[model samples]
Every structure is written in structure tokens, then in C-alpha cells.
Target: MQLFIHQMNEEASNDILTWQYDRPYDFYNNERTDEALQEILDGSYYRMNDENNVLIGFFCIGANAKVPAGNEFGVYNEDLVDMGVGMNPTYVGKGNGFEFCMHVIRFIQEHYPNKAIRLTVATFNERAIHLYEKLGFVSEDKFQTLFAQFQTMIRREHQ
Candidate 1:
């Protein structure tokens, strides 16, 4: 499956903001708010599409990808590339994550060469954590937010 990455646009941003995941994962759902839209339009986020031009997901890097709560715990002290990802609800658990993630990883590697990568994921999301580990990310720190526990994982530049 070939994936194309594009700068986040209003249509794709609106589509992503409405994607509702089941239970637990629903925490990722967003309201169609002005602030949310601005974040995607600020140039930190990228939309991913399949060969047929179907929106598959979105990925964001830098500060936009960092969990705000993690700042208090110093979980993001390092100068690494932080990444956040969300897939269309319909694609969840359909076995396309590995490929989707690989594409994102490659994109980051090409754009931010030599920097380590970091990801913050909910601790209950074993499926996602396992996928990150398989992609060479190692558990670095764990922290708790008001709503959930999270683990910060990192894949060093050399990995």
C-alpha cells in the first residue's frame, strides 16, 4: 500500500476531528473547535492518504505532538522529535497499522534526520505500544494524567 503525505487542509482536518473511536480510544476524539482546526492548520500536522486518495490518518510533530501534561513531569526534556498519530476509526484494528506507521516513520526520518523520535501513548493502549516497540521505540518514562496513564517511548536516531 502506497501512502501520500500532505499538509493538513481544512477538509482533512474536519474529517479527522469527527473520527470517533470506540471506548478507551474515544479519548482521541476531538470536537470541531476553532483551536483544534488552527492547530492542524499551523503546519505541524500532516494528512496521510492511500493510493486512492482516501484519508487514512494524520500525524503531527514537534510541540503539537507533545502531551501538555508531560511537561510537569519533565518527560519531554530531551530535544527529540515528538510524534502523534491518529487513524480513521474505520481502519482501527484492521491490521494496517504497521504499514501506516512505517510510512510515518520514514517521513519523519527524511524530514528530521539524526534526531531521536518520541511518542506518548496511553498505557492501556497495548496494541499501539506493541506496534511502537516493534518499530524500535523503547519505553522511556511513564506518567499519569487526570484521565489516563501514559507511557513515553523513544526510538533513538541509530535505531
Candidate 2:
């Protein structure tokens, strides 16, 4: 499936919440709601969309929620940021996830230079793990449960 990456606008933001509310991949089924979507659209939280001219899925990058202080992925530092992404079920397994992540990596790296950018993946999510690894994200010895996914921290190195 073809995907286009873009910054989240009001309409897309609403769609993201509506679609992600009960996402199978989301650890917390309650994470997505009209309020949460409004926060993203308001810019307190940031968002990105994997659009095929339509909303397939979206990502969130928030402040002060970077790398955790303790984790198994072995990354224990504060010079990083945390992000999460979710897609509409119709777009699952269609490479949109990987593409959205790659786009996010590029966006974060360019926007937050000299600081590490990080993401968490579930231990059981081999597909996501592989995708992050392929994108040059080194997996930390860290793991946690966010929603339902066994989270693994991945950090992007400075180029």
C-alpha cells in the first residue's frame, strides 16, 4: 500500500483517535479518545500521519516523556524522547508501520539534533522489532508493559 507522510491537522487528528481507540496493537485500549486527540491537535502532543491521501495511521511525539530512567534495553539516560504510533486496522501489515516509523525517525532526528530519539516496542512484536532494527534503532535491554505491548527501547544514533 502506498503511504504519504504528513503533519497531523485537526481532521486527521480526530480520525487517529477514532481509529486507534480500540486498536489491536495498542496496549491501552483507552488511550485514544476525543480528549487525547484534541491534545494532539492542540500541539501539547505532536502527531504524524501515514496517509494514502487518507488517514491510515498516525504517530505521537510528546515532551518530557523521553527515555525512562529504568529499563532492560539497557538505555538509562535522559537525553532522549519517547514516541508511539498506531494505524487503522485496514492498514496493518502493509508496510505502512515501517514507513511511518522511518519517517518519524527522520523527522525527530532532524528536529531534535544532538539528542537521542527513542521508541518502545513490545517484546512479542517481532515485526516491529525487526523494522526498528532495520531503521538503525539499537534495541535496549529494556522492556516494559505500556497498554499491552512488551515495550523495548530503541535509540537512534547521531549521524
Q: How accurate is candidate 1 locally (lDDT)?
A: 0.93
Candidate 2 residues 1-159, lDDT tens each? 455566668776666555543334554343567676666775534454333376666666754233343344554445576677666667677776767677767767787776666776666677777877777777765545443335446575643
* Model 1 RMSD, rounded to 1 decimal: 0.7
Q: All candidates' lDDT scores?
A: 0.93, 0.61
Clashes of each: 0, 10
In terms of lDDT, the best-performing candidate is 1
Compared with the true structure, what per-residue lDDT tens digits does model 1 show for residues 113-136? Answer: 998999999999999999999999
TM-score of 1: 0.98
Angstrom error at residue 109, model 2: 1.6
Q: Which candidate's TM-score is highest? A: 1
Residue-pair clash count for candidate 2: 10
Give candidate 2's whole-model lDDT: 0.61
